[model samples]
Target chain A: MNPPSGNAGAPLLEFDRVTVRFTDVVALEDVSFRIRPGETRILMGAAGSGKTVLLKTAMGLDRAASGRVVLMGEDITRRPETELFDLRSKVGMLFQESALFDSMTIAQNVAYPLLNQKAIKMEREKMEPAVRDSLRFVELEQTMERYPSELSGGMRRRVAIARAVVTKPPLLLYDSPTAGLDPITAHTIMALIIKERDVDNTTAVVVTYRYQDGNLVANFRYNPNSGRLDPVGSQGTNTIFMVLRDGRLAFEGAQAELEASSDPYIRKFVKRPERDAA
Target chain B: MLDVLKGPVQAVQGFFELTGRAIRNVIAKPLYLNDIFLQMDSIGVGSIPIVLLTGTFTGGIMALQLGRELQQYGQTDQTGTAVSIILVRELGPVLTAVMMAGRNSSGIASELGSMKVTEQIDAMRALGTDPVKKLVTPRMLATNIMLPCLTVIDDFIGMVGGWVIGMIVYNLQSLRYWTTTWQALGWSDVVQGLLKPFVFSFVISLVGCYFGLNTTGGTQGVGRSTTQAVVVAAVSIFVIDLFLGKIFVSGQRGL
Candidate 1:
């Protein structure tokens, strides 16, 4: 039910022995994981290691051949398309390529989810402000009128992130949010993701290849407010850092545990590259 | 010779694969009539103006050319009968199908092809929605229903075009042209013209969507598939028309 209490309680999102097979290829095989409410779970894997497939499965984009994708205690497998729209509305996804509609302006792109939902039709008038607020949230308010083709790679990703979070979904799924960006820009995007999780109490599942020290530090913050996310030194905020590899839980527990991990893969993952390697 | 045979073999294989996919899709999820109606609006209603203009001009040109030739025998009065018969029985359906193949079939192919190239079709599948039901079936049903309707429109327009040329250029009376055309042409001529387009519609849509769904590579692949779909559909229409014409005309002569 809650993240900071460790893996004792029910998780907000759980994959129970999920498998995805495409002809001769098994994209994911018997993959299982759990992320409790208010957790920032990191799915780190090498390229072609099924991180994207895992994220897609959780988002209900990729159906598992066998097993269940339980979201908030409900098995969403075989859910009707109409109900899937509602499920999708509750989870926001940022694709690696941004995948913004080229025909739409930044504001229109951000407001897409709102317009797509019939339930939000009466609230259409509020879409503009929501778009503006989401853009402002990502620090891209001035680029609202620009098309996707007009934006830089970083700007486009931010716009995509803005669009994904515009509906203020409880779960935010990000596929390589900082991929193909410079180090500084990648850190900035990661910081924004951290800020969103803190401010909105949004549980985030980010699939990425980069493992930076600052990102690790950001993942280990402790705040005391509601055990979801509070400012550092706040009364009730607790953070747990996790890493998944080869479609399984590779490393979990406190930041100190990860730092002290003598496992070769964990050591290599946590090791800061020497100046020569850099 | 072997290399040339390769293309046909590949095409046949692709056709079989597409048919299998279509059958599986239909079994998985069936398309509704409302979708067919919307597609009819796209393939038929939306295409009417172009089909009319092209059919009329083709009819007029045929009449003008044939009129000049027939005047040598002072068989000019028979021009109305000849033009009406040809237009209603053969030219109308064939020409309309060819034009629709260029317009509606190619457009559908290109649009769907581009979506495939861009992974939008894959995106729909990932969302557990059948692209054939959502995209292809409606268009196919629409084309099947609308092609015959377009043929009827083409028949009406073609006759009017022949009448215009007969009255204005040849100094024939409009009333005489209509009476001669009506007396010479029968329900069978109209039925023959109408029948071919229904079959042609299926060929155009199936080939178009088939090529589109299987398109790969990038924008260039989409463009190539779109062009190939139109060419294949148009050629198949004429070939199919020739056979249908033989059957109908021979049956009538035997009668």
Candidate 2:
């Protein structure tokens, strides 16, 4: 059965009536959202509004109290953990903190997914080119042998992006991918995210609190043939923006719809400073 | 009061759950051999000097103290018997176990707690890596292999310390001291020494992993887990020692 919020065709992810609680607090309650194939859904919420939890829940990193998580035509809400590896291999998640294993080098971290899978486990030398290519994808090829601790905040996040997309997973879930970086770094990270979604046709679930970040990904289109991000007219309507507030989906629509929203909370959230507006 | 009972019960439940997962992951496919070897180096080879130092001082002191009693009765030759017997049957294993609980257990807890705080552990789960297999199992296996090895090394070093005392300080006959030391130790003593460390390894590593995985808050939580690991393992070592001692003693008597 198609869910209430599900888009046309089989959705890559569906959080049907999902609720998550931590003791007395409710992080997410009866939250349902569907991400269809080739669609980018930006999950944005204020700090502590549970955007990260929603992103993690979709990846099965966080448990839901009572809900059905249907993924790619299968109900996996109660799927056994052993079976989840196969589920996870199809989805790549970038954490808020990058979460690169500090014990490993950039190359080693990027190669982690390749090394974990049994069928794909090849010799170290054989894995090098793919690992290097992933690093190059994020424009950090020179930092391959360096540890995560050695890199700046932005560089580590880029490495994390490289690691996330190295396997070329069909679904990419990013939690604040560009949250803490400077403008250039944030833009670079967003460009890579767009490239992955647009060039590779990867379905994406991006979590961010900044409206500009959401607008940035929706504004640009990656022309695979041209190998560059070209400004799209009307942002192509392929990207769906969402605002989560108080454990529920408060807003869901296109960029224009979100910008035009009259809801007071959304107004305050979407309102830009005088410099940006001017 | 309800919360009090609930906390311990929940902790014990989580502890067993972690233990069961470690057991399953140990025999499962795609074993993390590199991690296991790395942990072996950290827990076993890295612990050599400390274990040897602890053993030597402990054995030397025991010799000095017992030498006084034996000298009073002109039974100085028998100091070797007493020292060897104590080191083999109790001091070597117990001492090494305590040291490991302090060193390896706290290290594991702090490392894992920090990871939990930083979301690296969750990151691993999201990336399709079971932290238990990639992280816990290797440490468990490493501790299991290394603790016994550490106990053996401790016992040997302790015996050397006793020998140094008997030959030089006490001015006892080398041949007599060596003979009594060997004669005082039976196969049972050796097995007993080795046995307790196996039990202690499981206690220390599992407790550390347990405290680590359950950590909350931030840096403070990591520190709590580290302290909790050491305290729990130290207390547990004694409790486990008591029970294992009872069983071994009765079994030896039966034999």
Candidate 3:
């Protein structure tokens, strides 16, 4: 498939039959997919179905036991950790738990990627403003001095988002960004994600259990002029929906194809009450 | 049958791997000097009160018990010598490490375990910072540097406790007590005392970090790692102390 940018260059991420194992347990098995630049891929699965593992494998945080993973045109399947740092700096990831350093304040957390990423070389004076700008992007500029424990879960997730995007990488991965949030809060989180996608035009892979979240990503665009999410229609967006079951990809297709899938496992993810009729 | 041994074998292998990585990170670029100082402040300065209290009482107890034994041999004035020898050569290092194993080992385990379960360590790596270099190496270096300092303070305070007991309880002269305590410690005894805590520091930090980084499950897993870190570190201290003491003894005997 062509990327949203219509750049027929190399894909941003490609997995060729990737498998990951922990001891005797297979976390991800023979999972193959290609994520092009400016495309958002939404991955859905039940708990322990390797959604998180797949994201980690893509980032080179977890090693692939077999097959190959080419990220940003580099074959990272067998790349040593030291060599992967520069490549990883170009790809931002939000862990499932927010994972902000408990010891650091919100500003410090946001500045972490900028200061630590070897590929990023901002002047020291530019750091605070960049941190402030990032936090302001998340609408949490006032919470600079506050530790993560001081913030609510949604706010902490936003701070994590700020940290992830501070470097302004071309690729982003969000692991269960809206998990454990109330409906209103979940919508807010999803709106922020859509805003990140529209403003930067960066490729994203969102791991989520809620089909509603995926539906939003696939069906809406952030209208920068109106500062709101506008319906873009599924055809207007370059998004793919993937469903994993028991360490294997059960389904991978467009929203219409997913909605028309006959597989029970794939149907289970799309069976949300409010969106059932759609 | 081999399956039964796999768990322990893998654990030992993992521990060594982590130890090697941590050691290498000490000399690697991007040394986390700030983290090392922070750990020193926490692990070193935070340990003073317990070390002081334990040292003082241990010396007082030794004097009270060993003073009578010395009196029976017409060597009541020798209380300082005996206390100094035991405290400098054995008790001070082992006891300080045991106490630190109980305190810092559990502390490091719980802190790192919490980070692991919450995926903060993974986040650190994801952010282009190696967790072992940022987390484990600092603790290892700080513990290695500070355990010996704490041992020195413990030995000095223990001798002071012995002197107080000798003067007040045994009615011995202050000058005699000072002289005997001063003369009792040989170079080998000092070397043995300093070396043991140095070795125990590695056990304390590495075992705690090992269990912590490997923690799974959730909060329950953190608690389990904390308990296991303390237990393994404390046990390893005693076992290592026995071997070290045997080596020192064999050397003294020219065996």
Candidate No. with top TM-score? 3
Comparing 1 with 2 on TM-score, the higher-scoring candidate is 2
Q: Which has the greatest lDDT?
A: 3
TM-score of chain B of 1: 0.90
Residue A149 in model 3: lDDT: 98
Please list the C-alpha lDDT of all candidates, in the order they appear: 0.75, 0.86, 0.92
Question: Chain A TM-score, candidate 3?
Answer: 0.95
- Regions of model 2 farther than 4 Å from truth: A1-7, A119-126, A223-228, A272-278
- Model 3's lDDT to the true fold? 0.92
Query: Best candidate per DockQ, number?
Result: 3
Candidate with the larger lDDT of 1 and 2? 2
Q: Name the weakest run of 10 consecutive residues (lDDT summed) in model 2 chain B.
A: B160-169
**B142-172: candidate 1 lDDT, tens digit per residue:** 8878989888888779878887887777877
TM agreement with the true structure for every prediction = 0.71, 0.95, 0.97
Query: For candidate 3, lDDT tens digit of each residue in B3-113?
Result: 999999999999999999999998998999999999999999999999999999999999989998999999999999999999999999999999999999999999999
Candidates' DockQ values?
Answer: 0.17, 0.72, 0.87
